[model samples]
Target: MARGLSQPKRIVILGGGYVGLYAALGLQRKLKGNEASVTVIDPQPHMTYQPFLPEAAAGAIEPRHVVVPLRKTLKRCHVLTARVTKISHADKCVEIEAPDGHTEQVGFDILVVALGSVARLMPIPGLAEQGIAFKTIGEAIFLRNHVMSKLDAAASTVDQELRRKLLTFTFVGGGFAGIEALAELEDMARFATRYYENIEPSDLRWVLVEAAGRILPEVRESLGVYTVLQLEKRGIEVYLSTLAKSFENGHVILSDGTEFDSDTIVWTAGVKANPVLATSDLPLDERGRLKATPTLQVEGLPDVWTAGDNAAVPDLSRIEEDPSALCAPNAQHAVRQANQMAKNIVSVLRDKQPRDYFHKNVGSVASLGLHKGVADVYNVKAKGFIAWGMHRGYHVARVPTFNRKFRVVADWLLSGLLRREVISMGQINNPRAEFDRVSRS
Candidate 1:
């Protein structure tokens, strides 16, 4: 497939997220003495464990601990920090551009499409310029620094109108990302008020806007109700069945006719499959995800495999009950899918039949800041502190590499023992601004 030098077949993986990282790690272990030459390519040098991003934003975990360095971990594979420009199955090659803006084509005998989903954004007025998305570690750090900066601004300002705007934080989504981000940040900000001379926890107005009738659709409906109650008890406003109509100049207008000015507007509504699929010669489903069978092989396409958010893997666990059920785009599914996909890849390399992936929806767990959470595992429901422990235990076990797990646990322990870290490092966002101004002067 790669023009005759594929005896040790060239395996190229796109997007070093959950699937890429895990698949490479699996291959490194399974393929002995050059069973196949492996390569992994992604824009970022590390694979971020996204579930911990909220805690990273809240200062509960160190930002670096949540990401695994690709080069260090994927030792047996070639790691490339480059953007994939194109994939040509007919040519059996992929075009990539490095940070230096140079492009080149790399031939591959097998291709792994794991370019995960992107934020599902809509054309709302001012949303693009004003809305902050919660996807990457960079965004989490930015949000944290920005939120703290707002607190600093609110404390120093004498003008009530500006203070009100600075203190109001509006989150437009009620899924796991939105709820966790809002909850952790709100909790941290509230704790920070202890040091502020003027600001109070009650003075902060945290608003959650969801168009759906209910939030946390991944969990039990009763748990969703409980989460709303807990947030309400903490003085957070929950606007269910509402939409963010506009965010013109930070003037948030909701479908429910609620209008307010907020300095912070976060969008975590949903995610769509990566748009890169449209550029490739791969079979895609109606939703723009790769059409994959239960075995994680690209439908009707030889030498191509897919998993994670980019692959529309049939939910074999649900097929008995529902004919058209596909795996949801979550870490729970992504991680397991990668493990299975890797083994299947190795099996095919050794000239063996591949097996289908099957894992039941084990249920979901969500953290509502420190020591508070909700969980529904195996039809059993949990709430409050116990659920929070479950949330911590589950993720600590699942996060790749024991080193990262230890660090995350240690960070949690250290955070619990010490006072909440409350200082704002807003200057970090633009360290060169002052330098530029001084040079101009």
Candidate 2:
């Protein structure tokens, strides 16, 4: 509670992704001193700028610069690093599990459900144990080190079979994340091979598997086709309409009856709403997303709102074309929705009615690798270096605070002056091992 504000209006924002972070920022800006107390609860202390994860993994940007610390960023808002276990909207309270494994309940006058989504995993065997994800900053860093380590292993191995498996990298997905990560890391690996005396570029195998007929459905089909061609030109095998049947014991079995042994399997298939929503009393759609109105309010639920990947917000911009159309769960929509949601919350506080959220589909841009990309803005298509420039330019402009923007830009400038770091710091995974060894000695 804010000091000197007797019984300050409590406003709680869930999750620390694009929606929650921006909403908290908006509230802090709009609310007067001690007018409303804001609390943001998330499992992590920092909010990741997900769009830059690929670049970070590829050594284009430093990993630590890709996330904003919630506590440091939201100065006026109370930031709690905890997982929301249950949301009882009816009772106007939420149950949270702290980092220390303690559960506690907190009451809120207003609630914002922005729990976001989680990686959608399948029942594929060995995936849980073997397949690495390309979602978080940690995963990106891990994959970078893991990929380089594989090359090191391949260089040292004399066995042909072992070398072949060690040099193979398989990516499962065709979306922006999957494509960008695969392309960027592949470019990195190709460049890094020049430093390794035994490893040649041709020795590395990069494969992309997408169950869909085409990749990058967010962009125009023609652009997507062009992307596929560009990828294939670089010796990347694009498997369209192919499913990864099993990844058991480093052996990849595809629905196309293709079988291969790989040491690295990257999964970026899709994402589903956070499973915690299942325990909430709020109304949810069949797909587990919260039912939200165009105004970003939960239907028939006062003082409660939802947005981002976890809410099925009606797409007013597409209602004429498709009456049942819902907003695409992307950062573009999430940012805009958070701004509008904050405005609406302020309106309700002042006894004013809220307005609906409507934004036209601007465009989409994707970076294939350094100096390579494809973009479509307002039906205008751009490919190659121009698109890559646009991709970096657009993201830098939207990547949160000016402090972070400066650091990310500085990283890009520094990368131009220095060589890409390819050394695998795999030892970071087991920091205590050295201490244990020294203690025993």
Candidate 3:
């Protein structure tokens, strides 16, 4: 359609994550006058800004502000709210399961696989039923309400054991997701207790269990140590080099012979590539990730490209040092890779070779709680309020879309003027109850 020709090239992008959304945006901007038809297929209609999940969970920011609507953002691209069940590269088709229980196959001239990772679960007993994850906006809202409800239950309970158990919070994984969620929620809980006469901040038992020897491995070892100390100062029990063995019946049994009862068990340990890739005809690595070259193209497969967590993209910045080096699966890499992938795709369409993706590690930042954080940027370290400000400023700029950025900033400003919203609308979790009661009446 670019040159007034019919049947424009069809480019299908799987998943509406950072990689998928950004790639679609880039493609729409570059492909003028329908040079190509870009179709983005994802179960969700919006892309969740994961870095802000903790703030949303803490009620520091509204949940709605943390997600970018794909339809609104990608005005030029076709957005499909459906699950991609399988891909047949040989046939240039993908099987899609629609929301209305219908299935269909969609054909494409170029395919972009960006289906991200899912929670890396284990065989631990009771984890599936008792544990909650901190990945989505829904999970963040649920957690905020759940934590508040636990406090309400604790304040009303006469049994000391039940109250203690309700106040005990256990978080597994010391990574950004786990640590940030734990810190933010803990801060919120501490603030919420000021209104309850029966509850006190000192009564809360916050525990962090990590299998590795250190937390915040993204930062320097010294900074990681400092983070542990800061958390310890806040009365949080930091368990390093420990594994969560079992979580049966709200009872947590750790590898280090520590046992505790808690109502909340947050699992943010790690994530693995989406299992949906196994059904695809595309070549995959041992870890079940799509095998991609330095230029973001699928290995030995033309017209197919991959990026993000599900793609084993060669890290050219590290390949000279380590031949097997692959890009670290993070938002920073996903975003940059997506932009480069789009450029490469356009270049290929114009009869040119694609360039390899390369970028050096800038650094990492982690917020312990409000007004408390640690950051290592370009080999320089900062701690406390300054680091926290840097964390917020960096994320606020990277959250995508001017509309979303304005909304998020407004939420932050309003939160400063008003107290944190601790009210738990638990009934939202069971909306059918009222309807059922009315029907029976």
Candidate 4:
């Protein structure tokens, strides 16, 4: 058994997301000299702070600044850019698939199941080919370029029908992601029109469709209503209790029989726990999340721990009032849970009792656009400029390392002094296409 000061324990952390990255950082700080050998495995070399994805999409923040490089940040830990195919806690071994198509079995004394969630895509026709997800930095950058490129094409083309289709943007989802992304990009696209000779803000059609009756359910019902009003005030069409029935060839068909052609389609409805959990021997809830205790340890397994969006931890603050209360799969809870989980892992190493992770959610704040937002933190409700400031302040304070925070702050500061960036590098998305054609010629 790996314990105490006898020898270094081999520790492996899966999924370098908010939980995996932060928990590893915590463990690195908490562990004594040579107490444990830490290894972090993830498909990406960096952990993208998803909260700033909207800002990145809208060019309010540099895309590179929002992601924390794992190798540079975790100097003492082994960071591997690979995917975990399987987890077998009974044998304490995980199957890792490398990027080059090779698989290897990695053994560890301590295992952390931090694999996060993925975009919950529906089985809508044409979605696979046309729908874009807004979860990662790549997708965010693609959206910024795609939207602007459409505007460029529209400006040069005299085809009225094609121009209308290019200008029509449809977003299917009303959660924080869908709302913030739609708001910020719409704001950016509107700002971009200033440079175009023919295109105007009024010429662009922005549509938001949510099957639910309201958007931003993470906030409050009242705030959701206010958001609709704000979007409508900006000439955006907010369709609540509506669903996108189909999107074959960008010809959108809604449940309400609203049909229109759009060149851009963004899907941000919801997410399911990472499907990797199903392949593991660990106990999982109905939603395929790892079953974890309040102390952040995997159910029925002491050496294994789980947290974040992938773990169904009991909501300590609400469990007494509601026994069914489980922590929501969000960044706020994930970061806090990871911090506590790190301490728990260290306690076990030193033969001490671990404490349960608990923190009442402070609140949620969302940016609508430049100088516009809505927030409800600690029941202190706010809207417009006040809420926008709160949203920026909260995220800037929470975005990982000091270096990244400085850069992000500088991005906002510089944008204030200059006009919004309207240039589109759409060619970057198809950098190989031009080269391939040149080679053939």
Candidate 5:
């Protein structure tokens, strides 16, 4: 909390992602001097708009523009570049561990638990040491570089078996993340094949494995069926109701008794709320998400609110008819919930009545590539090129700051008029390459 503020309530926001940044920005705009002091605690100093991740992976946009600087944008809020190792809701304080390995306890009048989800993982044999996840910017860039490097390896290799494995890409999970990534990377690889004299489009193989009966379960089944067909039409294999039982020794084994050898494995299986939720004594739901009320507040806790993928906010809109339709963890709900959470905080401070959190599902849009997409917008379904355009348009408008919005738009415009660059700066993967060369003396 900042100094020279007497009796001013301190609002502590956890997580600097979409939810945290938006809520803090709204609170700063809604509250005045001495009204309340906002402090945002997060491990990263910036917030990433994840919707643009596929484009970044496809090399359509610059990676740096995808993240918004929390300190620069949320100037009014105190930005602590530290991880919230533990939270003490009962005592109205949180314990944050700094980058240099120091711990400190910070008190708060209002606690906002928005420590969003992390890539849900299991103790699958060899997965921990081999699989790569698509969650952070660093991971996105790594995957991009890794994919291009594999293409280079395949083109230069003389062994047929080695070339097949190097060019083969396997993605586990059929959700939005997996499908979009497969689509974008497939598009990129197909485009990149033109530059490789020895590598053709048919040389690369793309496979998607899903444990569920369908992909994009958030959309209607009809659309899911269409998505499978569309992917199949483009030579992408989709395996339904199957899980990667194990990837031990580079052998991909599915529950359906299928096995394949591939050099690249991308895991987008699912996400669970941050394990930090367990570090605190907060009330959690069956799936380990914080149990939050319709108003986005903790069920029995005062001045403590939760949102994003980490909080299980009840879907009263659908709870009566369908017991299983809780708010699907997506960006749409996060944005609306953050706005309402900010207003609720301001309302509590001013002794005003807090409003209930109610939002109609506005539908979803996903891009397969530059000209391929699937969307069900407000009950109107669209596919192919039009849907792809809508997907990019929706995300460009929703990507936070205008600076990022413009850059993303420019990238799209340039890509349409020019050839996609398939160059890989592999040196990014090894920062010490130059130092090592200099030290060889």
Candidate 6:
């Protein structure tokens, strides 16, 4: 029922993630009262702020507070709750499939390929069947419930082997997700053991396996060493320079010939660009990420732009003279890039000059658990409770939307008044509740 020019400039944004949300909102603000139409297509209607995921898992914050609904945030844009199946850049059309199995093609004047990264799974046998990833809200909630369920199972069981296996938690990878998740969950489990009749915190075995020699590589080497020592102090086993060959049939085989039985194996090794990139004819880097300049424009595609984990934007700040020195795939870079991309899009629309992206590293922070963390802010190393407080303060300010921020703050306050609930709701994992139903006769 709306009429405009015969054809208006259509800005199509894929994925409602960190980069996509920021870019869409920024565009909506910049293009106010313009004829340009911005349509954002993502499988989910919300954008998740992943920095708070560890706290959510540790029951320090509610899961819903960590995600911002895109429709509410981007009211001026058309929000499509659908998964992008394919893109024909040559034809300037995209194929989208909705939740109801309906498919449609949408035309675009300018395309923003922000289809973000997915769990970078390997060809290791049995990983698909036994491992869990930490990318989605569902995964975070399910992991929290699953971890608590393991604790309950361990405490209630009399079988020593089963108890040991239930208490044995293995996290594969050394990145922020892996390290933070391991630290938070281990702390939660340790705190929960006080309620168990027969279980002790010492009975639990927390193992971190990283293929690389160190963890939290984004931080300085000294900080990484400090992280290892802090985790070790809490009885966590750090297996560096190791790889998980397979987790087939509940038996975990490591490259170092070490084997373990664990009921929980969380794989946070790394993330690769979404496979959706292959469907498009756009230029991609060796890692399959869209080739993009610091200006956030895709190569050979004037009207198309890409950023976030899917785009390999050049690091203008890094004057190493190496072509391989691209921007790091992180929230910090994604946010700054999205803002710059939005500005460039508007500049081009208004026939103005756009600017490039160049920002110095602000440093990193990792929360180990309640009152325990590590941070390197402005080259100043901080650890213990002070770092933990800074971690909470930093993320609380970064969480998008007032609703989410208030909810997260409320969760933190309520947590102080109430004991951490360790119960598990495992039934939601399967939708078909009666799938196993059978006749007794």
User: lDDT for every model?
Assistant: 0.93, 0.94, 0.93, 0.93, 0.89, 0.89
Error in Å for residue 128 of model 6: 0.9
lDDT, candidate 6, equals: 0.89
Put down candidate 6 lDDT per residue, 63-119, tens digits, no spaces.
888889999999999999999999998888999999999999998989998999999
Taking the tens digit of each residue's C-alpha lDDT, what string does model 3 give over 1-441? Answer: 233446688899999999999999899889977478999999999999999999999999999999999999999999999998989998889999999989999999999999999999999998999999988999899988889999999999899999999999999999999999999999999999989999999999999999999998899999999999999999999999998999999999999899989999999999999999998888999999999998999998979999999999988888779999998999989999999999999999879999999998899888888999999999999999999999999999999899999999999899888967878877877889999999999
Q: Which ten residues in a row have the lowest lDDT in candidate 1?
A: 1-10
In terms of lDDT, the poorest run of 10 residues in model 6 is: 432-441
| Residue 36 lDDT (model 1) | 85
Global Cα RMSD, each model: 1.2, 1.8, 1.9, 1.5, 1.9, 2.1
Alpha-carbon lDDT of model 3? 0.93
lDDT of 1: 0.93
What's the CA error at residue 165 for candidate 5, in Å? 1.0
Q: Give the alpha carbon lDDT tens digit for every residue of 27-46 in model 5.
A: 98999897998999999999
What's the true lDDT of residue 394 in model 3?
Answer: 92
Model 4, 55-132: lDDT tens digits are 999999999998999999998899999999988888889999999989999999999989899999899998988999
Better of 5 and 6 by TM-score: 5
| Backbone clashes, candidate 2 | 0
Per-residue lDDT value at 233 in model 6: 91
Q: Which stretches in model 4 have alpha-carbon errors above 4 Å?
A: 1-5
* Model 4 TM-score (2 dp): 0.98
The runs of at least 3 residues in candidate 6 whose Cα sits more than 4 Å from the true structure, single-residue gaps closed, are 1-7, 320-324, 431-441
| Model 3's TM-score against the true structure | 0.97
Q: 1-441, model 1: which lDDT tens digit per residue?
A: 224554688899999999999999998999976578899999999999999999999999999999999998888899999999898998889999999999999988899999999999998999999999999999999999999999999999899999999999999999999999999999999999988989988899999999999999999899999999999999999999998889999999999899999999999999998887899988999989999998999999768999999999999988989989999989999999999989999999888988999999899999999899999999999999999999999999999898999999999999999955877888889999999999999
Model 3 residue 205 CA deviation in Å:
1.2
